[model samples]
Target: MTPPFHSRISGLAARTLQRLRSAVSGRLIDPRNYQPPLPLPGGLSRAQIHDALTAVSIDGSASGELFGYASSDLDRFLYTLAMVPEGAVGKALEIGANPYFNTLLLRQFRPELELTLVNYFGPGSAQGKQTVSFPGFKGVADAVTFQYDNVNIESAALPYPDDSFDYVVFCEVLEHMTHDPLRSMLELKRVLKQGGTMILTTPNAARLENISAFLEGRNMYDPFSAYGPYGRHNREYTRHELHMLMTHCGFEVEASFTGNVHPDIPLGQADASTLNRLIGQVRHREHDLGQYLFTRWANARVASEKLPNWLYRSYPAERMAEGQ
Candidate 1:
């Protein structure tokens, strides 16, 4: 028999069945089923997409599903996992989980992980040990506390020995360490195990403003340095500068990404500049770089991966470290 003639229509029908199975764990569904959210942007700019989400936050303030997560925290969470490495995750840490999404990611992605959260201050039901001025945490989930050695990343003696965690998350946080970011990173590395991962998201100095500066032959680095913006972030990173920082600290830099869910008026989309100005007046690094091309590739199939969502999530890249 000639394999029963798998025609185009039949093949498509079979593939559709396969997809539905894969998406719904191989369950048959009626055509009237509620569709999951798609990542398609309807060709929106970065800010427009976030604005839409924010609008929902406004109208549905008491809503539980997406409302529980802060816009920034969810953005960070999406960015962090969207680019995770392939294979088993050994261990992970997020020095800053904010009040919303960061810890959610810790719980969601790697709940089995031994979790330790260090922030400038502690929030939520998470416990902490006052090692440094900053608050620390020990959140619940399948995750347990390795230790709440709450030393400031910028402080001397990071309160833990070297090569500690399998992964460390530094989201929109490093540049704020004006006192000694390098020392903080060194401490982060100290805790990160050899061949560990760092999922980093920060303001990109190489944004449209700096691109214009480059076209105008002006100094771009100083304009976006880690020195002073709202007197909060001591510096920001151009991709290369960040890579150097990680490499210098003995990190392989498993992945580096930019997610500006909090961005200035995205290019050509609804200006939102009024909202943009207000955000700028308060938030320091909101407009650095809203979207980025990925640098690394992860191993397993992402559960809920979508294009805009992936763009908004963490990406792995150039994990091949120099010495290691």
Candidate 2:
């Protein structure tokens, strides 16, 4: 399926911003900064790494219905997931694992992993709307279990007992839980074992494409969908915003960085040294930048004191009832 008008416009907007930066400045640029994350050490070349990351391809599929890590905000996340410190994973819980591309990737890269995939939907369920054509993951892990729970993340009690998982992968699910992100984080924290790892990825509200959207009195979201705002992205975050959310929920962030540029996004030319330098710096850490921000946090051995009143004070029960 073809991508919608908004996605194409957003991609073009992102490209134009980068190109403008490149053209307005004069200096030699390092080409490496514009490339994607470095390939993993598993003997796969860059092209192979990308293909493997996107284990399921939706190339000819229409845009909105397309699934998998290839073209969505999740592309950088799979790359970041591949880079999780080797040997750090044992038992893992994946929230929102409907598509399950990461599970497939980890099966190749970390065959010993045990995964529990928890989602509101999966392969055979009526809610299993995405990736219907891919069949299911094959020859992945020795153990992979699927569980279903459609309760809202903000207030629902996770079915698992406390401290049940060594790692929790919650990628690109946050923006969808706009009304109660803090509560969702707390839920994830409660299920994770002390010192367990939590790998998170979310869109950056300050991405260059968004900045352009704001200046033009437009937002890149699709407003007409059934989920409406939440169906697309109910909310997005900046690097600081995500860090604060994690800290408030008692997870100690270990490392953070940004990447996952749209393939159509432009990298400034080598001749536009000034713009290239700016782009390099922003891409390195922060600024008008990448499509998604990635972070890994360790569930602290000792939980912090309960979050401040302000954290939940704004979350009126009425708003929570609305459920985004």
Candidate 3:
């Protein structure tokens, strides 16, 4: 039945407002056509990487699914590899090295370096071994069985000596630190050689897609996962915040930039351009809008004994003092 005139007018006004919002925000980019901005590293082709990843077999269904997801995000993995310095040598540690996708690539590219892998499963520490088999580039099947230490980085001290590793790959693990991120960073600092390099990568909390999601009134947080809290991203950082954290952790930033590693599925040209222009007007857009922040830092000194007040609160008064 037809409503009253005022009711009909109100409906029309609501529809108009919806359309206006759509026009202002623009449409998202088609997911199928989105391509990665960076190319594969070490002259490796996508097909080779795909074949290698597909050959990987883990024990559990959840692990298999995780590996599959890592396989799909080839660009992200390659971009991470590219950020690692070619000159990096000596002992290298990879934190949270499950599925071992990047570990395989590291072995293929940097065979000279000794590698140690770490993963967290429970509250305490233990040692275990993992064996991964994949078809080599020469069409021959190859297997890698490596020993990995199981320790909760947030709580337990790493099972290593001081200045143990020359390089540490802490990619995509920071956001999963549910309790104490500073503790993990401090532990990493303790193990890394004083002048060694550490490559780290994490999702940018201020990426363009997040901005668009916020504008559209969509929830921006990660959903609960079947794999538990560590399976989901608990905290993300902006480029600036990461730099600040790294500096506070006694690392000197050697190189840092943000880039789109994932497909531009939900971000379109119109919205990106509009936001970019708006962001540019106030300050240089820079690499602030990229999907992920990639950085290489040198271990310079001991990590801060106190947590930065900006990042934490409700702590002991002395522990919450301002950071340098």
Candidate 4:
């Protein structure tokens, strides 16, 4: 028998209310559902990798909280590892590696790699040795300790001689630079061997969340951090800007794309669907809307050393003119 007309209307209204609640509350994508974009090296399983990374313990320090934050973002770290080329040998430099999540992964998967780490405490930080320990796994000991150097990449020249490293992993550090990111790029180019690769990753400024925020008339800037100026994201780059920066810095762009390393949050399905449909119409914007941007650049030519005017102002006239 068919329901009465009033009863059917009541059921429809209830269903509509439930959908509204879900749209308002939002949904979180389960981290366990993550799949690697590329095949993982060393024939390791995701479960094994998760166990090893989660097992990491940092000694007592102010950075302990920071280490915890890194632990929570396992997906981000794993994607970084996947982006790194396998069979890479020779010295690798990981800038701003204090939390040491990525450092540990590199040591585990790429045992043949001679890895050196660098961290900056602050402007007053001096170059010195500091050790970190992680639990043992295959091809590693029961406990592993790493000693890294303290150096300021933005102000001082890198302590290493030119062409010192075959691979430079400059992940998540570029956005922390308050000024003169080009200077740091030049320093990296100096340290990287000819034809060597530099893997650079940073948050995409044009990400979906930021777009949502702008549409809603909300501020999109990062909050001031207790960890000081370097603690917050000073600036973020879009995919196009990164390509231009690398080209200007004299690196041959090998491979680059944006991908979401973090789990997804509901952006209001209606709004999200509309945005996605619009983005689908534009071919260039399709790949530009991920949580993070990963790029591989090869040191091919002498750096042009020109700072694009679009990215800088209040500079010496000559420098601006040179970029123009």
Candidate 3 local lDDT, residue 171:
92
* Candidate achieving the largest TM-score: 3
Clashes of 4: 0
The lDDT leader among the candidates is 3
- Candidate 4, residues 1-324: lDDT per residue as tens digits? 111211222244554454344345543212122222433446777666655655666663444555456656766777677667666779999999867778877887767789988889866656655455444445353445567677778888878899999999999999999998999999999999999989898988987677766765676789999989999999999888888888888888766666676554445433544554554467545446677787778899888776689789988876862634
Model 1 CA lDDT for position 168 = 73
Q: After superposition, how far is residue 154 of candidate 4 from its true place, in Å?
A: 0.8
lDDT tens digits by residue: candidate 3, 24-45: 6753322112223454655767
Total clashes in model 1, counting residue pairs 3 or more apart in sequence or in different chains: 16
lDDT for predicted candidate 2 compared with the true structure: 0.58
Give a tens-digit lDDT track for model 2, residues 98-138: 55566556655666667776665212442222332233233
Computed on alpha carbons, the lDDT of every model, listed in order, comes to: 0.44, 0.58, 0.73, 0.71
Query: What TM-score goes with each of the models?
Result: 0.50, 0.68, 0.83, 0.82
Candidate 1 to native Cα RMSD, angstroms: 16.0
- Candidate 4 achieves a global lDDT of 0.71
**Cα TM-score of candidate 4:** 0.82
